[model samples]
Target: MKEIAIAGAGPMGLLLAIRLKQLGYENITLVDARAGTYTRPGILNASIFEELTQLIGLPVDFSDSYHLKDVERSLYKIAESLNIKIMKANFTGFEGKALRVEDEHHDIHILPCDLAIDATGSRRALVNEINRLFPDAFSVQPIADPSHKKHLMAYVKVEEKTDSDPPSTPAPYGFDFMVQKLEELRAMGWKGFVEPGFYALPLAKNKTCFYVEIPENLDASQHEKWLKTVVAFHTGKDNFDYTLLPASRKYGSKPRFLTFIVDPHQVNEAFFQHAQFPCVIPVGDAQIEPDYRIGIGIKSGAYRIKCLLDAMVLEKDQEFHIDFEKYQKELAAAMQMHAAALSKFYQEKQRSYEHYANLLSIYETVIASASMSKQKELQPSFAELIQAYAQSLYDAGNNALESILTSSGDIPLDKHGLIADEKKLEDAIARLIDAYKYAQGDLYTMASLKLNEIAHLYEKLADVFIQRGAYGSSLKCYEKANMIIEKILKDRAESVLIKYKHTQTLHKASRYEDMYDMACQTLSEIKNIGMDPEEKKKFTYKLELNKALALLHILHIRKDLEERDYYEDECNKAIKHVKSSPYLKDKHLLQLTKLLGEIPIESMCNILKDGDKSDLAADKSKRR
Candidate 1:
């Protein structure tokens, strides 16, 4: 009998041992440093379960998912039943045709084996030793994007409740409607996005897991702090459970950190042949780290083991030799395909975000217009659109929470559970456009009130996107907000709030010229419009402050003495206006004056001397 030693008793290692034993390998030893520890859940597909059942000649209890601990325990039990020796030891290194392992008692022994498999997953114990011994035989390359390498995860258990009736009526317009829908999801323990990199998955009726993708440049120690920051930003009284419990002590799920294998190590035939070691092969994450988001690596590992077992079949009259070449070719092919799929998956994610942003803009515009127009005809269709979008989010989020896919599969990249019917959004936008086109004089202004509301809502959504780290999506939202404001302004609509928002968006977009123009126009309009004494004082102070800030930003891009004097004068007037207002408290006036005074003249002049368009963008980005 040929002796086989498998290092690392993770799901991949244990599964490999169990399969080898079934293939009539009598002497198999499994070595692991962490033999009895389980930190997260294991993902399994129904197809994998089918294959496992056939291999073991026993029914694999099929389930939607299992904890990583359970998967390890089950496989360990099967290994024990098969009388395969398992050592609670660390695989130290290889010593000339044998594996060197340190036992639990710290005694070193050279394990003699005809075949050795490195199933050590990301640790890559045996694989790394081989690379060190024969550096030229393997090529280790880091993935193009390291964004998927680090992850943070935690679990929470919510009490199961009896079925309750959902809301019968649709929610009101603007932010309140979104708040209500989110609250409904929270009550049912539905999983959804908290931030761009942060999301939740429901494990069972009472259990859920929250995951956060760690940023590449962030230090490992600051992971907890970053998670807390994201939670605090998104959490409020109504959606507290959705955001707070994952990182909070009340649920008792302190976040755990996991590192994925970012660098894929490819082994050439020389490593196996030229190393002069007998049949030392790398498998599972030791060979390749499949994308962790889908947990496809485990499935891939299982499939490869089955192929390896088949390749191990001995012919009656032939010398026994493992087909290392075939295995390497298959491994390379699989990794190539996996890499392509992973790239496509991320591209799909970006597209999904864009689709969601588009749908959200259209829905917000339609609903806000319906409110402004007070046309009973628009109300029913607007309500249906709201219901469809909310229901889609609920369904898609729950589906994602329930199962971890083993493949990229058919992820709804274009739709992404934001809206069910593209036609609905298109129809609604068309209707709103028609309403605006048909309105006359005062009615035109009334119809265009939706523009102001939509612009304000888009600005708020953009802020949310910024908090979520979706910088591109946020920029798009800001652009949309500015576009709406432009539409309102073009119609000569009367909304001081929209004009103020226009100036802010232009500043954010780094369009300093447009901002200055809008600010100047708004300041002129404020003079003509009558307002209450306190209200007018507030608008005048804010508008003048924004105007001066815009001019200062413009001066950063170019040296203009006229513009510099104009900004200084504008700042003084704003400071003076804020100070004279009876509505302003002493502290408020002091803070306002300090805000204007703190713009460093020398620094602004230095920037003006050496600034370009890139400098202006950089300055704006820093401010944001």
Candidate 2:
């Protein structure tokens, strides 16, 4: 058996020991400064609990009243099921092949172990000591707050059966439960624990817990007053009822707040850099600081324990210290990925909150306007209401887009990632368009303009489609591109490049009539806009060539000789313009001249072979 000692009995530390035992690593000792196991439940998000379950090879039974219950109750159940005893008394420090701990007598007791692990939970004193003792090996920060200090939670246990099923009010149960409990407490004039920066949670029957926190350097008295007001609102009176627990007092102090926010896999980095640590390896909280939101701490701790176990079982000949460094890079990568995700979640929440506040204000105004008019007919129509909502939605989308454009640093942009988020933006735009189609207000025109802007965004989407070889979808995107181009032309008709591209897009889409009309418009626009003689001649030549092609097609389709002659005359005039142009000095111009030459030759050959030169000559002479 490989003897390993783990320090700290917090959730992460305890879980580490449990996972080690489960992996068949016997002779494991878990140490903490606390005399007994952790009794109160820690603040862990539900997602973290689910992650913990997967790491430890045990199902987390969160059906109980508390989501993150005391590790004593939860871990004990796991211990019984696995037949493992993973906990022990305090761990003072470590030496090679041994660890020291103190009993009640203040004497040090040394125990031999092959490996020592520091899983101490945010204990700055121990971290600093390690840094000092192994100057080059440890990276310790005394004032790090990985999770922002603004979060303060209160866990309260409401009195059971007091008002279990109060009247069936119109308020939602989830929203009103806390209010109802507060009312009951206020009626009782309960003077419970009142502390600054505190919130309450009801963990069990007739039991409540309060947690308080604040940002560093904040005035405690102001927070105290706020806490009193919150308690009064809850109790419906000016007091709280409950005894203050010692644990609450300990938590009330400004916490040292340290965060490892570094890459978790970099655990061995300090060791390599400093060449310290004779036998003990820091794991879990003692190893690195990870984002608290995603519960990476517990997962990383479990992973570290598993790594140690694997090394012991598979690399018995190699030293344990050397083996520990091998897994540090992997841990660092996992830590970085989790931290980045947590940062993104934080930013998104900030944006969503601002948007929600704006929407709430608009909704209030609509409600107020409806109330002011005595006549129900004076109220805004349903279409008007939807239009307002859709506009707000579009504005929120614009804010999100702005966020994306201005976002700094690296962000994930692969498929099913940030790109999927952009797709959601497209869906938002489509919904806005649908809203405009049904809206009766004058604002629909404004909405249409917004849709034009959205269509422009399709340029980015089109690039994505082209890369994926969805040519059919690419074609539809090009049509939308043309629609935007047309709108721009209507607004800025003098823009030559815009007009030119508009015609090109039409031709690409195979809209012959629209393309022909654009060519004629360009011809008139060049002369009317007062272009130089050379520029005008260039435009006239291209327009005449386009007209000649259009007329040739018309001639092929016409059955009547009179209509054919008319188209033939149009072609003749167009060919004359091309022949008289000074720009026909290049190979491309030579090619055009050659192709146009074939047209008259083919017509003449038909007339001569049929012995109808007199008729053809009469037709040509009439045109002349």
Please tell me which predicted candidate would have the highest TM-score against the true structure.
Answer: 2
Error of 2 at 236 (Å): 15
For model 2, the run of ten residues with the poorest summed lDDT? 165-174
Off by over 4 Å in 2: 1-9, 14-69, 72-116, 123-149, 157-201, 208-276, 288-300, 313-322, 325-477, 484-499, 505-510, 517-624
> For each candidate, C-alpha RMSD in Å?
21.3, 11.7
Tens digit per residue, CA lDDT, model 1, 175-281: 44443343333333323322224555566565556566555566667655555443433332222343224443432332333433344443433236544575677
Per model, how many backbone clashes are there? 1, 26
Give stretches of model 1 more than 4 Å off. Answer: 36-50, 61-65, 143-148, 159-195, 217-239, 242-271, 315-319, 352-624
Of candidate 1, the 10-residue stretch with the lowest lDDT total is: 162-171
C-alpha displacement of 383 in model 2, angstroms? 23
